[model samples]
Target: MPKRILEMTAIEVARLREDGDHSVGGVSGLYLQIIGASRCWMLRYTHLGKRKRMGLGIYPTISLAVARDSARAAAALVQTGIDPKRAREDEREAARMHDAKQLTFKQAGEAFIKEHEPGWKNLKHIDQWKNTLATYAYPKIGKLLLSQIDQAYVLQVISPIWSTKTETASRMRGRIEQILDWATVHGHRSGVNPARWRGQLEYLLPNPDKVAPIEHHEAVPYEDLPQVYKQLCAIKGQAARALRFVIFTAGRSGEVRGMKWQEVDLFRAVWTIPGERMKSGREHRVVLPPQAVEFLRNQPRRKDREDLVFPSPRGTFLSDSTLSKLMRDHKINGVPHGFRSTFRDWAGETTHHPRDAIELCIAHVIDNKTEAAYRRGDMIKKRVAIMKDWADYATSETTNPA
Candidate 1:
């Protein structure tokens, strides 16, 4: 037996009260249930000789008319052997998938770095990527969804700094472009990257060099080397010796900082810097003059497995800035790397050594790849003479025991 049907009205629906369901007859089997303070609608019916209930919504939110309409629809689905509960769950899952596809720019940037950071050559590059995003791009559009980013948003990140801090802005633009491309490839985003330069951003921003010119490192004048050499030899301690060796060897500060005792062969009189440590990614053989070899043999020995030729006080490879500070403290205007320039000038002007031999001494990649490929020998005989002469001239002004 069942109650006869009339359209359920708002007043009759509000009067619903009981410990269980109160039938509000309109669409068949529709019930208004009260449990404590909560009131909701449900459709009750039998299907396949089994009774089931499906929630329509809460009271006040789903009015009597709306509840009846929804219950009738659920009843229709049940009549056709469809489960409303499972259908609702499927609908919720689809909504979640849509939200996930709208990944924010910051989220995409972090994912990009995670995928690529392991392959990057230096830890500093990771720091650079994170720092640039935090300072520029993150504030501008990081919260926006990946698909929301456009050329206008990219301009917002880069335009202000493009002219004033050109180098930093250029790096940030490249980083943003890379992150967008990564997102697009992964299907989190689509279409051309707004940060791209070749066809898109290039038309928007001015050339970087036009805004800020590349500046060469300042060098010590070749004629002033005698006095500078004298002053350098007078300083005491391991850092001073390291600085002198950096100049004498014409090595990059990074190479000198990480120099190992094993890399030097005193008997052979050459320092073999491996490809991994060199910027050129090729093993370079620097022929040590007699003075250079004598200086190295006299250095304090260590018992550690990887004994550093010039270790810091903490027994680690010395900090690259250690030599820079040494020069500043001594009131020399030239940087440690500027010594290579001084060596080049001296080689070009004073020595009769072949240009390629001089280039090899300083580890420059010779322009003629064919010649470089064919030449197996490092011209040890000629290089030996040139190195000896350069060493002699450098030390000619300073004979004081250091």
Candidate 2:
């Protein structure tokens, strides 16, 4: 029969040190130290006629019982002709691969922007993506791996600012979802994107549009328009003239700022804006009213200038914000763009002008295709009448109540 070794305590081991012989029972084999202070458990093993040493664990922390269990498990692996060290190394490699698949949310967002920014029509869109994401989302989960980001982290990023800045928060959520979806499809992440909406995240958050309704540009009442128009006329500056031109042509600030002298036909009382400058990317001819034509004629022309009806003092075109700031400085609460809304309100409430003709005069893309196709001539005669009425009303003493 094999010798049965008794369980020895720490105190007994210390006493055995004085006696010059010590042995502890381990599961796989015997714990023996050939010399004092050089303590180790030797697992008796022979593989293919070569002896091997398997150190169990260090003393104190690795208790006698646990060390014995570890030695026994190591021996079992050897018995099955498997190398335990190689198995541990394989597990470490798998852990590294799993970590490699996860990407930080900020990293994925930047990648998404770089891939999609070139296709965007507006240059401001790219800046908006960077500014909003960096300000809001980056501070929260910028370091977290994409796969580790759950719905709770997404909520934390948006919920604080969601109510106050509803539209921006809504856009932020959409951008976050887009990046995460890209990560999932590209094999950098697994499982559903936590930022997704519809049935998935609908239950988690409130409808953004419902929280903050769309705000339309407030239109000046037609009755008060003459007073406002006279106030605008009272102001004397290049910005004032540019703003008046925008009001007269019913064109956007970009269109007015980008207008060239060549497009204006003074003899014929017309201005034909080119396709590139126009928002619709279609050439639009504006039938200049007597006031509109007179305003352009009185505009001071710079020497050696070839183009640009509204050139700055430095001979460059005026920026879009220049006229808007001038309006605000002059105590005009609304802006030059608000004049378009003012015109629409007057046409709707105070004038007999047809809706299609008014929309066409303003270069608005009317949805009725057949009507648009048939009305190829732009109803110039009717538009002339409408413009004359608008000039008269804008300069006259009239008031729209409410």
Candidate 3:
């Protein structure tokens, strides 16, 4: 048993500030430690043959009376074989967990976004996350505690939109699941994620693909493409000319719209689209036919806007809707993008082009892992022949008699 020092008054304890541990104690091993003008209450004790120290509280926030009481209680626990420091740590961790449980869904979501935003590559994706959460989730479950968010709350946000806006609803459910998963990992919540899609949400909601069958872009039939191409050439303006270029290359509208003069090599008859501009995140080379190379050579140079090959009137990249509007005005049945499908249909139905070369013309991702691993080359030489046939067919007045 440790000896108890004589109990001192508050005034005596305050006066003994010689920068060392002083027992101004009513309890054994209770101390008022002073070092370099810093004063704190420390309880010094032994448990199971090991000496230990525990910070009771800081003074003058914790007075002498309160310090003695804390020390006495801690010493009692020490006598019962409990390490006082470990007991204090356990209590504090429990309190922290309880506090974390009270965090609202919105708070947790914002924290998750903030933590991950730096690593995210796309700004549009970030905007979509913020927009969807604010529009659907915030009104429903944002204010609810993170730990309290269950299947019922997730269903409330997703059910109303599931059948009507299946795509958005599916994405929102995924985002909610990720946020909840992040919270669980950080100890803010527990249990299976209610927004998870597999065995959980699968039973709760209808399958997304079944609810909203994919509607492919409206494409002009291959037989009707010759007439459509003739009408497109008759129309004047940069947008019309750009549409012609799209038909010649069978490239995406965004890819054509954002095409730069630097990317085009008229001498070599090739267009090299940088990975950043391409959807696949890999650089792609487009084989330009003689007609397409001639068209490029004839294009007027804009000295002030030298970088872009197809800059809009304001000298910026053309809006996505620009070509679509041109088609609408000309009473064209299909979208500008649907031209790729037109080319694919024509080549598959009429020509002897290989399926792989035709698909690569439009930059479609190779799905088969084994095939993708083996096929490293872009087959630019094969596509050169394919593009020539496409351009000749597009410009010729004679339609396929078959």
Candidate 4:
């Protein structure tokens, strides 16, 4: 028979200051473990002929009354053939998993961005995601748990901006949908995404297209392009040269502004834009005409492959605004992007160039998948002839309409 241990009162337990384990009565195997200044509650028990110690909690905070109850519960588990220490560990693990799945909306968005940022080619795109969420979504549902978010919360973020900044609001809604989908896939959230546009959100929000009609960039007419080209040649500086280069190549302002010396080949009359730099995510080979080649030959050469072809006065990438301002200062009608439209009109209306060749020169993606698959080569020979003819026509002295 086991000897009966005396149970100690709260007052008696409080008086224990010796630096050793003192058995606190009312529960078997319960002790006040005192080591110098440290005091805590520890339970000692035997499982399968081996003794084990388990920490209930720290002293004072987990009082004598609470410790006794916890010890009894642990003892009950041990009596039922379970290791109380193992059972407690399992409970802690389950709690950790539950907490992990309760991530806030902002937390889930940040995690999703971090996970996918490696695959994103542009840092600006990553910044855009962060900025949009911070500006709109974060203020509304950032702190709310992913499981708690619904259509109402999503509308709270985007509704005000929907009618005013329709495009931005539409993009924000799409991003929210993606983040919610990512959370569901990762087990941080469950249920249908409230931000989805196709079936759910479509019924709720008014059509974005109807709210704000799409606006194309204003372009110069092809008939006036020759006169415009002549006037552009009169303007001096890198921005003017870059604008001319854009027109010559029929390239986007962003593409031309970010061009590096390595991309140019004066010897071969080719400017190869790598897939990463191109909007289509595919390499584009531009066949430079004599005028375009001459323009490149005259620019200051650099030893560094990464040096910008048209750098700013500070020796950095030229801003799109600089080119736009140049056009404005000289009273040139239409924006810099308008030149692409100008080039397209000239090629389509005036020239006898094949439709495919003209489209390829402007780096336009073919709408027909079968046609694109069959047209494997870039048709560089056709493009070279077309560009030369366009350049000659642009540089030619034409009488302005009287």
Residue 334, candidate 2: C-alpha displacement in angstroms? 1.8
What candidate 4 gets wrong by more than 4 Å, as runs, is 1-92, 118-124, 302-306, 370-375, 398-402
Please rank every candidate by TM-score, starting with the best.
3, 4, 1, 2
The residue pairs found clashing in candidate 1 are none
In terms of TM-score, how similar is model 3 to the real structure?
Answer: 0.78
Tens digits of per-residue lDDT, candidate 4, 135-167, equal: 999999999999999999999999999999999
Clashes by residue pair, model 4? none
In terms of lDDT, which candidate is strongest? 4
Task: Give, for candidate 4, the lowest lDDT window spanning 10 residues.
Answer: 393-402
In model 3, which residue pairs have backbone atoms overlapping below 3 Å? none
Q: Count backbone overlaps in model 3.
A: 0
Error of 2 at 80 (Å): 28
RMSD of each: 6.0, 9.4, 5.5, 4.8
Q: Please report how far candidate 3 places residue 196 from its true position, in Å.
A: 2.5
- Please list the residue runs of candidate 1 whose C-alpha ends up more than 4 Å from where it truly belongs after superposition: 1-103, 119-121, 181-192, 304-306, 368-385, 400-402
lDDT of each: 0.85, 0.76, 0.87, 0.89
Error of 2 at 340 (Å): 1.2
Question: Candidate 3 regions off by >4 Å?
Answer: 1-43, 47-82, 90-126, 144-146, 178-191, 398-402
Q: Residue 97 in candidate 4 has what lDDT?
A: 99
Model 1 lDDT vs. the true structure? 0.85
Candidate 1 lDDT tens digits, 1-402: 543245556886787666678888888889888898899888887777778888889998988899989988888888799777667789899988878788899999999999997666556678999999988988989999998999999999999999999999999989999999888888888888899999888888889888898767778888888778889888887788887787778888888878898899999999999887787778989888888888887889787756888888878877767788888998998888898898899999987889999998899988999998999888878888888887777787888523
| Number of clashing pairs per prediction, in order | 0, 3, 0, 0
TM-scores, all candidates, are 0.68, 0.61, 0.78, 0.76
lDDT of 3 by residue, 35-54 (tens): 88789999889988888888
- Of models 1 and 2, which has the larger lDDT? 1
